[model samples]
Each structure stands twice: as structure tokens, then as C-alpha cells.
Target: MKPVADATPKVTKSEREWRDELTPAEYHVLREAGTEPAWTGEYVDTKTVGVYQCRACGAELFRSETKFDSHCGWPSFFSPLAEDRVILREDRSLGMVRTEVLCATCHSHLGHVFEGEGYPTPTDQRYCINSISLTLVSESDQG
Candidate 1:
């Protein structure tokens, strides 16, 4: 499904600006599509109720309610907040074919999504996203 949010992106920045704005780890994962070591991310077992937004551009990506423990060594979601909020592409890196998920607003790499994993999810898909690529806006903060 190629659901685009719009013809133009909502956020744009130069490489230097992105590097300056994000921390080294966040820049690597969010901007460079690097992965954090499994089971070491901050949100792996987190149960805090909140909306997860893109760390790079603060686009609402996932909600805490949809987060589930897939034991895949990363934060996993069954779906995004909305279809258009994320862009999925074929990632052929690491000698395997996988779907890469990115923030539709900024085009920043969030992580890979796998389908038919048989993880007991409603969608049968795992949105294996890097924790560093997201920021949790707790439900209390919504007010």
C-alpha cells in the first residue's frame, strides 16, 4: 500500500542540520537507518500510555495502546496511528527483502516491518521500530 500523506513533505532539513539537531544515537537510527542493539532500547518493555511520535519531526506514528511485546528485541506495533502517517518501501539491505517504514512527514527511517510472522497480531504484521526513532508523549501530556 503506497499511501502518501501528500505530494510534499511536512519537514525538511539539511544533513548538517539534522546531525546538529539529533543526538549521535538518534541521528544514526532516525537519519541513517541504523538499528539499536536488541533488548536494549528504552521502550522495549515500556507500558506507559502515550502517543509515540517521530523523534525527528514529531509526527504521530504509534499509540501506546497498539504496542505489544513480540519478544523481537525491539518495540513492536501492529499498526501506525494512521495509514498515511507512514510510508512503506521495499528494503533490500542485509541480503534480505523487507519493508522499510519511514515517517511520512519527514521521510526519516523508523525501522522495518515484517508480514506473516505469525505473532498473534491482528494484522499478522510486526512494525519493528527503533525506540530511538520515537518520542513518547504520555497521555497526561495530551492536555
Candidate 2:
């Protein structure tokens, strides 16, 4: 895994242009640190095979095979496609300290990363991702 650098978010015109092309929901959650209501996101119950990519920069983030029903009212992934593709920040808001995760490529706020401690997986990292932060590419479409 590469070291996490304080990489200034790549906010090129092309990235902004891509963002502008997305719907309001996508922009709010992916760019504005907003959350979609429970079970309302397109990927919440989606069982199709695909890869989820950043909506802003098209960077591969999560694999469909790793996604599971977290029942936390959001899309959950055991791990990101690449360790360096996401950056973890310490969130000290809401009167609590939680790990906030963001996309490294474009610095889009994906959601929070928590330890799945005591449940399963030794690493026990649960990346609770917002569905709007991603754009799904079906396996068929990738060919």
C-alpha cells in the first residue's frame, strides 16, 4: 500500500464537468458529504455482479463480490479495491470520534470506516459507503 499523502484533491475542470453531469443525489452524497436515506439507494439491495467506481473520477473503489448486506442502512464493503484509493480521516463531529473515509483520487466523501470488531474478518474494517458516491459498472458492461 502506498503512503497516504496530503494530496490536494484533483479538482480539474474535467472532474467538475463530470460531477455536473451527475444527478443531484449523486452530487449531494458524493461531493457534499450528504447521506441518502436508508434503503433508498440503488445499490442497497442490488445483487448484480459489478464494480463500484467513484462517480467523479471513475476510479475503481469496491468490488461487487465484497459487498454485503450490512443492515446499517448503507452500502458496506469489507475493503476498498486498493488500500490507497481511499483515505481515512478522524471525524470529531457529532460529539463523537469516528473514522471518516474519502476517495483519494478526487477526495470525495464516501462515508465512514469502522472496525467490524468482534463480528468477523480479522482486519475487521468495515467501510460504510454511501451509494451515491459510486457509479456501478455491471460485469456485462465491463467486457
- Compose the digit string of candidate 1's lDDT tens values, residues 1-143: 44334346689999999999999999999888899999999999999999999999999999998899999999999999998889988778889878889999999999988878798878888999999999999999998
In candidate 2, what are the lDDT values of residues 1-143, reduced to their tens digit? 22244577765455467567778887787777778888877788788899999887788889998887778888888888888788887777769978877888888889888884544654567788888888899999999
Instruction: State in Å the error of residue 63, model 1.
Output: 0.7
Off by over 4 Å in 2: 1-5, 11-19
**Every model's Cα RMSD, please?**
1.9, 2.8
The candidate that wins on lDDT is 1
What candidate 1 gets wrong by more than 4 Å, as runs, is 1-7
Q: Estimate each model's TM-score.
A: 0.94, 0.85
Q: What is the RMSD, in Å, between candidate 2 and the native fold over all Cα?
A: 2.8
lDDT of 1 at 60: 96
